[model samples]
Target: MSTLIAIAITTGILSGLWGWVAVSLGLLSWAGFLGCTTYFASPTDGLKGIGLSIATNLSGVFWAMVIIKLSSMVSLEIIGYVITAIVAFFMCAQAKKNWLNFIPGTFIGSCATFASNGNWQLVIPSLILGVVFAYAMKTSGLWLKEKLEADKLVEVRKN
Candidate 1:
């Protein structure tokens, strides 16, 4: 539980910081950076999870700026993305899921920002892709867990 909370706080802070930077630089929002960073920060264990947590949280701060760039809706974007990400992270962590948890927020944040920019072209695609990615991650994580368990069982039998 503590770990999950840490992840949410970390992701949110990163998101906000990135948002601020994006807004300052006149970038359309930090969605691209957010996505890239999330993928990069995927946790393999305690050490990697710590680093990824820091990176992911800070990336979310950038989403605030993304909202600003897309619709001049800084507050909405911040609230929407931050709340969703925090909640999703906690829930998914408790459920022991991985990147699957972040998909909804990413999709919503991306689509919302793009939709505000009058770029309807990207909204649907982003949402669809997010869902697909989430599904993939969920399945993969479960598969890996199963394999690990099976390996452990084999070792125990041999012992």
Candidate 2:
């Protein structure tokens, strides 16, 4: 199975399991973010992919809180774009290495903050939980793949 598909299934289960929790804690609100981040971060850099995503998730949440707080001082409807640009620029500047796709991943995580109406307190926890779940889902997927497809390549090539 594809890693992304496995992630989707894992998070869906988690979401259904956590429906009683608030939006911020529910996987339904975060599975997409986690899947996209894992997809972009897992392409290369091997073990470092998870580390890169961890940093991106945390940074994304922090920038989100910054934007949300700034929303109180100005028009988020407009200033939100400006803040997004600045944050994107800042994140891209430091992403010259394996994390070149970090911007999109962070955007996914950061946007979750506003969507959930979450505060800074949830940033660290959310990021941490996301990273942990993403990793666990990925590893479990690889294990399942190896176990089930021990003899088949199972590679899907599109031309």
Candidate 3:
């Protein structure tokens, strides 16, 4: 099988499994899917991608929480916008760190948190699980492709 085909199969299967698991656990599957997408979209692959995805994702959640808390403390409508601007600056600035360099991951995480109404409880697990699923899908797909190639090579040698 082709590498793309293998990856597609794994992604499809894992996506279904993740959906079922998320619904069973009462968590938002879409949030998990966002994390998975972020992982795949990350510049680096393997453990580096996982680290970048998780770190940036959590940072986004933290920033969102800060915005929520600060917004609650004040009544001015503009304060929310100001707070978000500051947080956005920090989010981008945090890329100086190697693990938190994925700026898009942070944005995705922040959006997920906001969508969940700042429910870190649900967002955290969902994103982390999604990253894990992405890793599994990638790893398994690669393995499957390699196995198929090896089998093909052996057949060629016999002929």
Candidate 4:
């Protein structure tokens, strides 16, 4: 089977499993999906992707909190926008560091935080869980593909 097909199968299976686990644990399923998506979108694969996803996503959460806190301190609605803009600048600027270079991951994290109304307690764990799922999906899919290929080769040899 193709690598793509293997990944698709694993992703579908994992999504269902994750959904059930998330609900059982009272965690946000969507937040976990966001983290999983962030992992796949990462520039690198394997452990690097996991690290980048976690780092960038958490950084986004931090920035979102800053925006919320600073904006809330003022009466002007424009202050919120201004704070967001400033935070955005730092988000992108932080890309100078290799680990934090995934700008989209940061944005996704920030959006997830905002969506959760800055509930770091729930969102943080959900995001990290999602990254773990992504890693499992990728690794398992690749392993499945390899196993299938090996089986096919053995059959061909016997034939």
lDDT (C-alpha, whole model) for all candidates: 0.43, 0.60, 0.93, 0.95
Tens digits of lDDT, candidate 4, 1-159: 999999999999999999999999999999999999999999999999999999999998999999988999999998889888888999999999999999999999999999999998899999999999999999999999999999999999999
RMSD of each: 13.8, 6.9, 1.0, 0.6
Write model 1 residue lDDT over 1-159, tens digit each, in one string: 233454444445555555575567544343434343444345433334333333333333334344444444445656767655665454335323353334434444444444446343343333223333333343445555666678889999999
Model 3 pairs whose backbones collide = none
Predicted structure 3, TM vs. truth: 0.96
Candidate of highest TM-score: 4
In order of appearance, the predictions have TM-scores of 0.34, 0.61, 0.96, 0.98
Per-candidate clash tally: 21, 0, 0, 0
lDDT of 2 at 157: 30
Model 3 worst lDDT run, 10 consecutive residues: 63-72
What tens-digit string does per-residue lDDT give for candidate 2 at 52-98? 77666666777777776766777547887787678667766756656
Question: Which is the better candidate, 1 or 2, if ranked by lDDT?
Answer: 2
Q: What is residue 112's positional error in candidate 1, in angstroms?
A: 1.8
